[model samples]
Target: MTDENTADSNTSTGTNTAEEENQSELTAVRYADGSLGYPAHTLGSDGNPPVDTIDLREYTAEIITWTKATATPPGVREPNTLAIVEFEIDDESVRAIGQVTTTEITIGDRVEPVYVSELRDPTAGIREPDSQAWDGYRFKPIE
Candidate 1:
């Protein structure tokens, strides 16, 4: 009999191929301790199209890679979520604390990781965005 696991292993080795295709492909992903979350990258964002992009793969060395195999489409990058992260993929460290609000249906440059998809991930972080503060009321002169 033949070793069942041996022959099949060659094709599985192609995992590297997928990475090659994604090389410099330009995607937006959550940056945590420098490691990236799988497949949760955006192909493009407003004003900035897929034509010019940010290579998240380049930032992988900052931390451990954490994410599912599947991919997500382009949408708003949420600042609120990005703020709570204990670490970031960016070269510099961010000590963020603020609040932000918006319609659930809408998205923008600010993208956030869904709790279900990201909370457990080691590299992921929570958001603590700031709320919009109201201005004091103005007084009117009596006629």
Candidate 2:
């Protein structure tokens, strides 16, 4: 562990021990931040900062990776679609019209409710109702 103090820099340059001399392509990017090691021509994405420096570990060569963001935002609001509320005999209670806090499930979409009939202990979660449940509820798709 005594050598751990300078392990990273040593491992990164350990190739110096090779018998045959070869040009090395790995070089650390020099930035105001002396810890980052960005590669040449590596363009940073929008809303992200560019890497501009390499940090040498004291005893071990640590490798790092970077990539672009992967998340896509849901599209504009579907005015008619309502987030789920409780279901009753004839229809389900939706987040009422223009309620700021409520987001609704698209009418055709299924969703889980927090609770159903307490006494029956029916599953509160959204379920693909079977033919019997559909027939009992008279479930219909809204235009």
Candidate 3:
């Protein structure tokens, strides 16, 4: 992945050009009250509008919990491992849940977001492939 630190040149626009070029970067919402949230919220926890956005790919998060799902939604992988991770940004904690790249993770393990073109086989689902997005980020244990 490209170095996120070098993407600072585009901060004036509130958009990271480096992140835009890197699909692995996870987009997160930044609230006006100085809080961050994943899955990008339309409104803040305090009911205020978002102030800006941040790329979670620039940060490394710690695993809080994990589990394996044997019964998954259609098109998703069976026995897929998922984890809830916490990222510390500006002294605040932002938690998100996503699939793990592998099952070799544990609590307290550090992870980084990696882009997956298709989290599942879209065609394998009941709905039309173009009806919904199939790409997403996955957590990979950091070396």
Candidate 4:
């Protein structure tokens, strides 16, 4: 007679496979240091991982949740309202900080990531600064 354990194992494996297939193919970028971000990547030779360019720029996401900041911390240039948001990018969750008016955000609103160019020091004249722009990302609602 066939082993009872073997029969149960086959059934469980079949159910797991079906559930996995129903899930989205997207996977989150959970780093070795325990930080999570989007456009999943693996470390490179230089020990820095680059996220996907196409995914960050072209994808539209729905806001899963967000909060408006109410306090100003020391050394902050301006005590502007900030929103800490969690949203999906290609089915993967990403948390990003953005400056937004307190009345602007809403749950389930569609948003997209944006990059802003870093400012240049006027004192460092046109000789071409030694470094490239360190632009950063933010999430904004799609118009």
What TM-score would every model get versus the actual structure? 0.18, 0.18, 0.77, 0.41
lDDT of 3 by residue, 1-143 (tens): 22122211222266645444655457788898898878887898899988988888788999999998999998887778889999998889899998887767779999887766677877886789887557667787777
Best by lDDT: 3
**What lDDT tens digits, residue by residue, belong to model 4 across residues 27-112?**
34544344556446676334667443333444556666665444544322133434555655444556655543224667777765
How many steric overlaps does candidate 2 have?
A: 18
**TM-score-best of 1 and 3:** 3
Encode model 2's per-residue lDDT on 1-143: one tens digit a residue.
Answer: 01111111222354544411332222334333322332433433332344443321111111121122223222212222222222221121112111111232233332221111111112323543241121001111121
Summing lDDT over every window of 10 consecutive residues in candidate 1, give the lowest-scoring window: 134-143
lDDT of 2: 0.23
Give lDDT: candidate 1, residue 95.
Answer: 21
Alpha-carbon RMSD to native, per candidate? 22.1, 27.6, 7.5, 19.7
Model 2 residue 102 CA deviation (Å) reads 53
lDDT of 1 at 120: 23
The global C-alpha lDDT for each of the candidates, from Candidate 1 onward, is 0.25, 0.23, 0.77, 0.46
Candidate 1 lDDT score relative to the true structure: 0.25
TM-score, prediction 2 = 0.18
**CA shift at 56, candidate 3, in angstroms?**
0.4
Per-residue error (Å), model 4, residue 85: 4.8
Using lDDT as the measure, name the better of candidate 1 and candidate 4.
4
